[model samples]
Target: MGLQNTKAPRAKRANIVMLGLDFAGKSTLLYQLRCKDVFLTVPTIGFNVDMIEMERDFTLTFWDVGGQEKMRQVWSNFLEDADGLLYVVDSSDKRRLEEARKEFELILKNESIKNVPVVVLANKQDLPGALNAEEITRRFKMKKYCSDRTWYVQPCCGITGEGLRVALERVATFARQYSRSKETFRNLKEMDTL
Candidate 1:
C-alpha cells in the first residue's frame, strides 16, 4: 500500500482574472498566448477560463470576464479572489476614452479588487488611430490608482502578439511576488508565538 501511494496529487492552481470592454481584444490576446491563429472571432457571452502551466510547478488559471453592459453586474463575483488583473483597452477607439476612464475607476474602487495588481494592455497598436502607451496612461488617469502596486501599461497588437509577451511576463512576476509576500507574512506570524 505504501509503495502504491508514492505519486503526489496535482497542486492547486493560482487564479488570475482579466477584464476589459467589448472589442478590447481579450479573447484575441488569449489565443495569442496559446500560439494559435484567429479563425472565427466572436464576443464572449460570459466569462471564459483558460489554464496555463508555467515553469516551477505553477499553473495560472485565467478568468476572462465579458465586458458587455449587461454582463458588468456579474464581473465582481469573479474579481473577488483574483490574484491579479489585466485591463485591455482598444487604443484606436477615441470615442470611448471617457467610458474607459470610468470603467478603470470602477475596477479600482470595487472593494473586492481594490488591492489587486493590474497590467493594462493598450491593444490595437497596429491600427491607424491606435494610441500609444503614454496617451493611454494619461487618458485613463492611471497615476491616481497605480501608487499602491506594480502596474504596467503596454502597447500591444494582440492579433500578432506584438506586446503580449511583455504583459504576460509582468503578470506572472507580480503574481509570484504577491504569493511570496503572503507566505512571508504567514511565516512571520507563526514565528511570533515562539
Candidate 2:
C-alpha cells in the first residue's frame, strides 16, 4: 500500500481589534508581538494590521487602530466583525485613567461587539509608580463595563515584552470558546425558526 501524506489543518483565525488613547503603546505592542523586539513607533494616524500565530492552533490578526481624540469617533466601525479586543492603557498615566475608562465604556456599548472577549493591557508596568493590573481593573470598573463579556486585565511592559504572551494566550482561549458558543447559538436559533 502507498503511504498517504497528511498535513495538519490550518489554524483558526481570530480578528482582534486593539484600541486605546494615543501613547498607550498600542503600536509598540503590535510590533513587539510581530518581531519579539522593542520597536520605536510613531502615533498611528489610521490603522495597522498584523498577524501573529498564537498557541492552541489559532492565528490572531490584530487591527491596531489610531487612538487620537479625532479618531475615537470611528472606533465603532471596526467592532462589528472583531472576534476579540485588546484595550491598552498607559498605566503610568494615572491622571488620565478616568478618560481611558470613559472611552472604554463607550466602546463596550456597541451591540455588534457584545460578548466579545477582551484583554486590557495595562502597559508600562515597568515604569515607576505604574498601576498594577488589579488597580487598573478597579479604576476602569471592568466589572461594570465588561459584565456581559469575557475580559481580563494584564499588567505588561511593551518594551520589555512582559506578560504579553500570557495575555494573548488567554485571549486565544476565550476567543475559541466564545466563537464556538456563538456558532452553537446561531445553529439553535436557526433550528427553532425552521
Candidate 3:
C-alpha cells in the first residue's frame, strides 16, 4: 500500500523549561515577559511558573528553576514531559563560563530531555565585555549539542527585555515543529490500524 502524507496540526499550548547558572537572569527574563518591566529579583530558590501568550495561536508555560549547584540535583525531577529548553547565560561572566558549560552538559545528558529544541539566551548583552551570541554558541559548542533539534541563540538584555520576543518566537516555532512530528506519528499509527 502507498503511504500518503499530510500536514500535521500545530499545538495550541507548550511547556518550556528555563534553565541557567545563577545570576544569568532567568527570573528577570520571566518577569520581563510577564510585565514588560524588569522588577528587582532575588535568586530563585526553587522555581517560578509563568504563562504567556507568545502569539495568538501559541501559548507557553515557562518553568524557571533555581540554578544553584545544590538545586541542580532536582532539575531532572522536573524534566519529565518537557517540550523544550530555554537556556540563559550571563554573557559577561567570563570566570564562570566553564562551570556553566559543565552544568549544561549535565542537563543535556539527562535521558528525559533528549531531542527537544533549545533557545539559548545570551543574556546581559547590555553589559560591557559580554559575550555575543556567536561567541557563546561557539564557546559552548552549542551546534553539536543541539544537532538533533532546532536551536537559536538570541542576544539579549534581561533587565530591559531586549530580544525576549525573538527568543519566544523561536521556542514557539520549534514547538510547532515538534507538534507536527507527533501528529504525523499518531496519524501513521491510525492509518496502520485502519
Candidate 4:
C-alpha cells in the first residue's frame, strides 16, 4: 500500500553568499553569528557553509571562501550565483593590505559579481594595531565603490561577535533591495514585449 503524504511544504528562503580572503575571520564571524565560542579554528580547506535564520521570511547561506593562494582558484565558481558579497579583511595585518586591494579590484572587475552589494568587514578590531573604519576606507579607497551600491566598512571583532549583527543586517537589506530591483527589471522587459 502507498503511504499518504501529510507533511506541509516549507516556505521559500533567500541565500546570501559571502566571499573573502583566508584568515579574514569569516569562519569566526559565522560562528559568532550562531552564538558559538571560538577556542580554536582549523584553516578551512576549501569552503565553509553556514546557515543563519534571519526571520520567518529569509535564510542566509554564507559561503566562507578559503584565502590561501592555491585555494583561490575555485572561488569564481561560487561567486557566479551569489546575491551579495562580504569582503572580510584582517585590520591588524598590514602585510596583506596590498593583496586585499588587488583582490578587491579583481572582484570589482568581474562582470558577474561586480554589481552585487558588498559589505567589507574590517575584522580584528579588538587586536592591537588594528585599523579603524576610517583608516580602512582610506587605505582601500572603498569610497568610490560606495556610490555604485550599498557598501560598508564595518569595524568588527569576529571572535567576540561585535558588529557582526550590524554587518549581517546590512547584507540582508541590500539583498532585499537587489532582489526587488531585479524583479522590477524583469517586469519592465515583459511589459515592453506586450
Whole-model Cα lDDT of every candidate shown, in order: 0.82, 0.91, 0.88, 0.79
Q: Candidate 2 or 4, higher TM-score?
A: 2
TM-score of each: 0.88, 0.91, 0.89, 0.88
Model 4 Cα lDDT, one tens digit per residue, 2-97: 998897766434456555677888778878877657646777888878877877767778888788888777767787867788888899999988
The reply for model 3, stretches above 4 Å from the true place, is 1-11, 189-194
For 2-99, candidate 3 gives per-residue lDDT tens digits of 98777677648878899999899999999998899979999999999998887777788899999998888899987776788998999999999989
The alpha-carbon RMSD values of the candidates against the true structure, listed in the order shown, are 3.1, 3.4, 5.0, 4.4
CA shift at 25, candidate 3, in angstroms? 0.4
**Candidate 2 local lDDT, 1-194, one digit each (tens):** 99876987867888899999999999999898789899879999999999988766878889999999989999999898898999999999988888998999999988999999899999999999999988998999999889988899999989999999898788778877887888799999999999
Clash pairs of candidate 1?
Answer: none
lDDT of 2 at 109: 86
lDDT of candidate 4 vs native?
0.79
Per-residue lDDT value at 133 in model 3: 94
Which parts of model 1 have CA positions greater than 4 angstroms off? Answer: 1-12, 186-194
Per-residue CA lDDT of model 1 for 35-92, tens digit only, reads 5565456888898899877655777789988888877778788887777888999999
lDDT (Cα, 0-100) at 193 in candidate 2: 100
Candidate 2: residue pairs that collide: none
Candidate 4 segments exceeding 4 Å error:
1-12
